[model samples]
Target: MKLLILDLDETLIHATDCYLDRDPDFEVGPYAVYKRPGLDLFLSKVRSQFHLAVWTSSTRLYAAPVVENIFPHDVDLKFVWSRERCTMRFDPEHHDYEWAKNLDKLKRRGYKLEHVLMLDDTPAKLARHYGNLVRVKPFLGNLADRELFQLSDYLPTLAETPNVRRIEKRFWRKASTSEP
Candidate 1:
């Protein structure tokens, strides 16, 4: 099965220290964590088609509890990696250090880059492997957001592609729909 690495913060859920107008689905320490709409259905539908894992830049202290609450107990993730697992790089454009999730790290663990897909909101974090990335719009506690619902329909289409990297996924939203 292909490995699908999911991002945590704005990609899947929005964790804010300040409360939004609506109550959060769950809380993580002082953060009000809101699950992206259709998150549960997305996970459920994709679980059988792909091997799932989480690769968040957040610390284990923050990521663990959030993962525990969001993912169902029956759905076993291949791994839940935290900040320590990310590669730190100095971004000259931003003039600051950023954590990047390198797919080479997965190659070291016996996974093929062609069989891996990363779902993340930040393109810069996966700049080294744009081929493997399926970018999503950042979710910010929008009650009516529907990205995940659309994503659930799009992802399975790539499940059997010989090399997922070869497919143009930057416009996956459009590719998934009949829209031009």
Candidate 2:
């Protein structure tokens, strides 16, 4: 099976630090995390096709709860890694890239390097593994965004291919001319 790495904030859910105010989707006490529309369905679909895992720059203290909220008990996720698991590096050449999710580290952890794919809102985070990346649009609590659903439509194509890197998505090709 292929390994699919997922980002936390903005990729799957939107979070805010406001207390006593709840987002329309869900609330997590002092913080409010909005679940992207069609998230549950999308998760179920991908879980069947790949060995899913959550890898994020957020701390476990915050990320774990948000993950539990959306992923739920029924959704079977392979693993969850927080900021501590990330390689904290700063490239002297690029100043903005503070935290990059290095899939090279994941390779050492037993996930097949070539068979791994990552879905992340931040392109910088996937710079080291661009070949395996599906650059997801940042979901900033927008209820109208259809990226998740659009991604669901594209996933079956990836699932059909034995190696994710070998996928030449017609959806991506078609989207470049119109939408993504």
Candidate 3:
């Protein structure tokens, strides 16, 4: 199966120290975490078509419990990598530092780049591997958000593509809606 790596934070759930207007789905330390709408259904549907994993810029301490609460126990993650796995790079455009997930690490683990896809809200985090990315708008505790629902419908379409990197994904939302 093709590997589908997901991001945490704004990509799947919105975690903040301050409370939002509504109660959070779960609490992790000082953070109140809100699961993105349709997260459960998204994971369930995508699990069958891809080898799922998580790659987050947050510490393992923060990412673990959030992942536990949001993900179903039946869906086994191939790997759950934390910030320690990311490389610190100085972003020339943004004129600051950022933690970038280098997909080469997966390549070292014997996974081919062509068969891997990463879903993240921050394109900067995956700057070195944009071709493998399917960027989503950042989720920020919006109860009515439906990005995951649209994503679940879009992702399965790539399950059979031999080289996912060859596909242009910047306009994924439009592509998803236009599909027959």
Best by TM-score: 3
Measured over all alpha carbons after superposition, the RMSD of each candidate to the real structure, in angstroms, is 1.2, 3.1, 1.5
Stretches off by above 4 angstroms in model 2 are: 19-22, 91-94, 168-180
lDDT of 1 at 112: 98
Across residues 110-179, which tens digit of lDDT does each residue of candidate 2 receive? 7777788888888677666677888887888777888888787776566556677666542453544225
lDDT of 1 by residue, 1-180 (tens): 999999999999999999999899999889999999999989999999999999999999999999999899998899999999989987777888889888899998999999999999988788589999999999998878888988888999999999999999987888776334
- The TM-score ranking, best first, is 3, 1, 2
lDDT of 3 by residue, 111-151 (tens): 99999999999998897899999999999988878899989
Candidate 2: residue pairs that collide: none
The predicted structure with the larger TM-score, 2 or 3, is 3
C-alpha lDDT score of every prediction, in listed order = 0.92, 0.77, 0.93
For model 1, the superposed segments whose C-alpha errors exceed 4 Å read 178-180
Residue 160 displacement (Å), model 1: 0.5
For this target, which candidate reaches the highest lDDT against the unseen true structure? 3
